[model samples]
Every structure is written in structure tokens, then in C-alpha cells.
Target: MPTSTRTVAEELLYRIGEGDTERIAELFADDVDWKLDWPEAEHGRPATPWIRHRSTPADAAANFRELAEHHVAEGAATEVERILIDGGDAVVLGEIRRTARPTGRAYRARFALHLTVEDGRVTRFHIYEDSLAVAQAFER
Candidate 1:
């Protein structure tokens, strides 16, 4: 894995692929922050969406925890196919397959995530997915 931004991002992907939430939590800092290109509805909801995402390490940890939980029980599993990183940012191309969380409908969607790492943790993220496909799957 990389030691700087790229490495950190790879490690993050590794941990996620391995279903290692504990190690994933350790990568974040106390006052890490983030953003999203999708919307509040994708991750369910985040209370307010107008303000910038100012999250603590606990928040990051919980985010993964929720994802991990959902993946095993409710959501699809992510299958990473390719990844590229520069400085503290990364672009991941992957796909997901399984039942949609909360909707209980089968779906498969291609995804690309732009991520930024800082202090050995993910500080920002923007998610891009086939929303129309996801929505269609959820309806079935």
C-alpha cells in the first residue's frame, strides 16, 4: 500500500474490501471532515444538507460501521475493479451487487468515488453512482 495519500486511500479500500471496520476506523483523525456529490438521501439522511460536512473521527467511524452493517445485512457488497490516486485524492471505479438497503430490491450499479485523504484518514469524499439504476432497482 502507499504511505502517503495514495497509499492511505488504498488501505482504506483494502480495509473496506476485507470487511475490517476496526482498522478502517483507526485511519481517521479526531476532527476529520467530508462532503458528498450525491445527496442526503443516498446515505439515508444527514439531518441538514446545506451546511458543510464537519465530522469527527467518531462520525467517520460510524459511517463505516453503518455501511458495514448494511452491506452484510441490508445493502450490496462493493466490488472494486480499479483505483487511482494523486496527492491526497483518489478515484475508484467499481461496481456493487445485492439488495438495496431499506428497499429490499435487487440491484447492480457501477460507481466512481473521488476521495481525499489527510492525516492518514479520509477527510473528504464525493460519490457517483448510477442513481437511475439504483432507483429503478429499489422500486423492484
Candidate 2:
């Protein structure tokens, strides 16, 4: 069988949910531009990711260099709610349940991504989410 856009998107999220950094990188193209938008902008840490690209697989690997040492590797996470795909453009409307430590409280935030695919990899991605919800989730 061949890989469809919807399949690719599903697999990508599945990989992320599993915290498989390698698999996540594999799903992105060499020139993949990952656009991330965080609701924390007005709080001073304006998280606006216009693009995230690499020239080669090595570049992609390097991009995720920090993931290898992230404290939350064994996170208990899942994409609880989502409205998954759109053929070549995948859109996921969901909330991710994750925690840094096993004893920590689960952080919940809503997300919606508009992804463009090419050669089975994600070429461009634009993210949208309720920043307010994210901020509230992070509240002390």
C-alpha cells in the first residue's frame, strides 16, 4: 500500500504522542518549516514560529538535538480529542495530556494545526490554539 496524507499525519501525531523524537523528525521534510504559535506571546515570551526548516536529514536531526535530553521523555501523553485530517492538508483539533514528572499534574492545552505535505513529509505547518487555555493550564 501507499502512504496517504491522512495516514502520514496520523502517524506523525502517534509518534509525537509516544515521544518518539526520531519518528517525528522523519515525518518532516529536509526543508520542513514548522510554524508554531503559542498563547504565551502577550506574557512576553512571544512564541511565534513562522518557519522551521533544514537543508538535510542531518539538519533535521540537529534540530531535535534537545529532545534527546528533555526531562519529560517518559511522559504519559495522548491526543485525547482531535478532528484529524484533510487529505493533503492535515488539521488536528485536540488537547494533549502530558506531564514532566510522573508525580506532576497533567498539562492540558488545545491545539489545531494546518499542515502541508510533500513527498510524504511535512513541508509546512501552521499552528493555532487557544493561548488563553494554555496560559491557564500553566497557572500556579
Off by over 4 Å in 2: 39-75, 100-105, 132-140
Top of the candidates by lDDT: 1
Write one digit per residue (lDDT tens) for candidate 2, span 10-95: 77777765655676778777776654565334533322121233455455455445323322555544463655556677787776
lDDT of 1 by residue, 11-118 (tens): 887776666667776776665646545545554543212223536666665666665443335455778888887777888999988665555567787889887787
Instruction: Give the root-mean-square deviation of each candidate in angstroms.
Output: 4.3, 4.9
Error of 1 at 138 (Å): 4.0
lDDT of 1: 0.65
Q: What is the lDDT of residue 123 in candidate 1?
A: 70
- The worst-scoring run of ten residues by lDDT in candidate 1 lies at 45-54
Residue 94 shift from truth in candidate 2, angstroms: 0.6
